[model samples]
Target chain A: MRLRGIAVVWGVLAVAAAAGLFRLKYEVIALEERLATLTHAIEADRRAIHVLRAEWSYFNDPDSLDKRVGAKLDLVPMDPAHIIALDALPFRPKPVGETAGGPARPPRVLNPGSAAPIPVPGQKPATLAEYTVMRTQP
Target chain B: MMPALLRSLVRRSSRRGAFLYPGAEIRDLPGAQGRHPARVRVSVEGQAKAAVEVGRNRLAITAGVFALAFCVIAGRLVDLMALNGGEAEAMAAAMAASDGPVVGAVVARSDIVDRNGVILATNLPTVNLYADTRAILDPEEAARRLVQLFPDMEYGETRDKLASGGHFVYLRRHLTPEQQEAVNLLGQPGLEFEPTERRVYPQGPLAAHVLGATSTDNHGIAGIESSFDRYLLEKAEPLQLSLDVRVQHAVRDVLLKAVDRFHAIAGAALVADVRTGEILALVSLPDYQPEAFSGAPADSRRNRATLGVYEMGSTFKLVNTALGLEVGGYHVTDGFDASHPLRMAGFTIHDDHAQARWLSIEEILVHSSNIGSAKMALAIGGDAQKAFLDRLGLLSPISLELPEVGKPLYPDPWRPINTVTISYGHGVAVTPVHMVNAVMPLVNGGWYRPATLLRQDPEAPPPGHQVVSARTSDTMRSLMRRVVTDGTGRKADVAGYLVGGKTGTAEKNEHGRYRHKALLPSFVAAFPMDDPRYVVLAMLDEPKGIPETHGFAAAGWNAAPTAGAMIARIAPILGVRPRGPETPVAPEVRFATASGDAGRAVH
Candidate 1:
């Protein structure tokens, strides 16, 4: 009886040991598969980042900017003659305020050495106050 | 068998012994020998047989274990040699081939382009020549032939490289395809060719400051190239910027002509798409050609559009006026007394072109009165002014993708004096990019979008924020138009385009004092003011008054007329049709007045 009991205990231990060993082997295999999947994902992400950075570098190129604008805008190259200087602006005489007669009287040109004056048509004579007021008004 | 033999021998000896020996006892000798001889032999034989069986069994088990272990080891060896041997051999070969010292590797670079799929920058294929000096049979002959092929190569340098006992040495880098072919014809055993990449700029110096140039080894050193180095080095796709090449050429051409006409130290121009916040064209001169970047002077390489910050003169009046209308509740027809200079905090604010009378808000902007702007700023108060400018991105360093950006320079601790000076664009300094970006909201329906360089998906969500009221924006547009049509920016008016803009001429700060003789002339304008689309800006640095300018380097004399020429030349190219002769002028300004205020209805 005692020997039989000892044999049963030893049998249980051997079965348990075999089961544990098989489970350990399967666990190692599962872990390796997970590691491989994760590694692939990481590599893919790195490649994507690389592609985006390359795209950025390409877009900022200077020659490309010039061509697109030229094609889109119907522009011709300009030279110094195209630009006008402030001094070249034609001058205009100041205007005057309205009078009861329906309009202000035009400025008159004084004759040399004489009090008599020659009237200019379609031109209004403006006072200092009126000119200041008009100049300030938008 | 040996035991049986011994037993028989003993028996014979016992039998032969004298049984009758007088000294031998009968019970001790003769009786035992006769009874147990056969039994003793059988027991001895059985024991010997059992020992032999055990020895054989033990030997059999040992042989079985040894055979199993040997087979497993042999199978593993075959698996390794057959399954992975090719890769292992290749690795070994690579190791052997790289036995010489190594210099820097020629790494691949990235491509650059405009937003419209145009190639602005690219890396062309090139070759580098190298030599295995230890393999050279005649160093003198090799050096002489190389020198003859490449006259630029110093003879002494080539000879030293050839004679250096090292196994490998670099002969030349960035060799053209023709040069490589010529070298290959020599057929020197030690000579080898290594492929490399060289950066190429197709646009010459049109956008030199913005694109920047790379070094010989393909490392970016300035502008957007240097700023986005890591992206350029690692990314595979080309970078797409929001610049338009045609606009860049137009703006540059106009500014170049202005520079020659006015003898300006430098010039810059920028055109921005207000709706998308894309910088259509940005030009800075004197600009350097990227192809000859190394030979350019330091000043030529500086990006004035995005790097140099300056006081923008009367241009700041637009911001102040907007703030007054928005925060101070001032209407377009609100009146301000411009008859006298305003004195505050020991400073007198006066307009260079004074208007000595009570002027309406619209008139003040049209005339660009310094005193009027000061009063409006005072009405808005200091806190509101600061907040408005800050919200407009005028109080800090602008956050753009490019590395060559400048920070706004303002007085610390925002004082009243600073506020007054800033109102007239005196105490504050900002880059031209900042000015263009800040003004975008005024014409873009009050939305502020940070500029982008990449091509954006049309389906993607919008990437901007609203910074002003749409009503205020419309009002500002009208005011800008009036300035061009009948006020200070008359020179910027393009016929049939309804052009609108502001003019500025700032005195250069020299030795802590304003230089009266030197002026920085600038103009900012937008076309078809009814529904603003694009904002254009041009500036001339320290432009000298010329004969044509009547000895005046003001914005009207220099920058404004340049903008006009640029718009006229570029308008049709931008797909904007010239207005028909009968097209009515768009009424830009809508005057809001106090109810019952008696005035000739100002439109």
Candidate 2:
């Protein structure tokens, strides 16, 4: 009687284990399908982005802009006289209610959180030999 | 008795109660004998017991058969899952290997961009349409519809391809998405779409010669595209060039107008940084659309600035002057006699500007005296002059980043007469790029920076050797300033830009002699002469004299004024700070006062 009871218990456990294994096998197949779908979608999005970036570049071409909108917008080349030294520009006045000379706000930076030093407006730009901005995004 | 019991078992099963006895238990079953043979032994005789033994043997054989089947199945599972991971790894490797070229093909080629990241050339993903020709039910009808959809497709060609009965045929390539949709809406079987990439030029002929074009297979065929094809194919990043489209537009705009006004056959213009040797703008008019470069006319496809070698008239005077200063050991103030024609080596050398008296080296250039320049070149000697021009990179092809660069034409033997003609810019012929490159070091404090189209790192400039003393460069700068201020390049002088340059008007050499009607006029200019930063060059092929030019198709009339307009247009975009009159061209103050009198000889 004890042996029969033991056999019955083992049979039930084996049936449960078989059911779990089949469930795991199906889950693997479903996960693989999902992975393939996501990969294809990501690839498709990347292709779309490439097309959009190219179109953006096309729209911003200088010669086309000059032809299409130069006269309509009354655009003209900037004159050397229009570019002034930093000292020539007047300092911005304090806000209307802000106190002067007491705990002034820190300066606003262009590239926030970056460690590069803020450029002084009137400083001479670096020479072409000294300037390098190749492949900054890559 | 055993047979009788078997009979009773059969009768018990078939008829519900055929073997019924008073209080009889369930009738003995033959199939149950294997499990409960003890009852059969007690009820039946010795013969029945032997039959039961045979039943037991059959049961054992059936159980063994089932066990062997399960063992075989388990062994196959293990073989598939464990012992031979090698096949699985190979399949995985094959998948990974197939992935690499697909990604590479999608990149196609790196973009060609201007210095400011404006796209000059790029690639767009597209779909190509193909067909299983055998699947088409009606070739003529389908071809007609296809021709209607894609107007560029020929009806006869499409029909022929459709009826070819081939397994696969390409209908069209590089189709737009809308066209793909229109084709899909036809709902035809066996039609397929193949994704691909095609090179595109966004700016369209703006810098066509610089960006070049690609072939149908997406291989570069010309210009920067050909020169850096390998690098472009390998790298995914954009290829950055030194060209600035804004400056190029200014140059193109001015040069186009000048070419139109002068009625020239063609034209070319270039601007380069004197210090860095970076070309900012290069325009060769009669330029073609890069998108259709292969089909463009050969005349428009010629890269005039770097390919067309011509006898650059009086502009060689700048090199002659520098050569004189460097190797001839002539003082700027020393006088050469220009009062009469120079007869040397079976040639009569004379002057166009004609100052018929003793003239200084400076005066010779200011007056465009061919006789005086020839005399100076004779003193410099043929060998020394050749050597000097060679050091300036004028005797050979310029080491610029273009496949179209032409080798400068000069007398290889270095004859004395060759020296004389070369001095006044006659015998030697060079492309416009070499002219600009040769003139750069003379005014840029004498550094031989070879021209490059690639954008360079400003912090560590490419190393260059000094070709002349700083003093010679200083003298050349002042002399160039004087040219704009006083001489033939007068039309090139801008009020605040302090433009300095030389003008060349060579009678176009036909066969072995110069022609009177055909002309090649060019001007090379440097700005803010005190600290020269940029050099601008303009050249025109066979320009006719308009009424406004007073029928003078000289460099002074057309090329010089064109250079001036170019400077005015591009200076603002280049960020050159303009200033008012600050200093004189030269400190040595002297002018030839012999206009009225052929004065005393100083030579």
Q: Could you say which candidate leads in DockQ?
A: 2
CAPRI category for model 1: incorrect
lDDT of 2 by residue, B76-191 (tens): 65444442325645756877986632254346688888899888888888889998977888988888888989898999999999889986899999989899999998877767
DockQ of each: 0.03, 0.13
* Candidate-wise lDDT, in order: 0.76, 0.83
Whose TM-score is greatest here? 2
- Residue B132 Cα positional deviation in candidate 2, in Å, after optimal superposition: 1.1
Interface RMSD of each: 14.0, 10.7
Residue B573, model 2, lDDT: 84
Displacement of residue A21 (Cα, Å) in model 1 is 35
lDDT tens digits, residue span A33-68, model 2:
797788677777777877787898788777778777
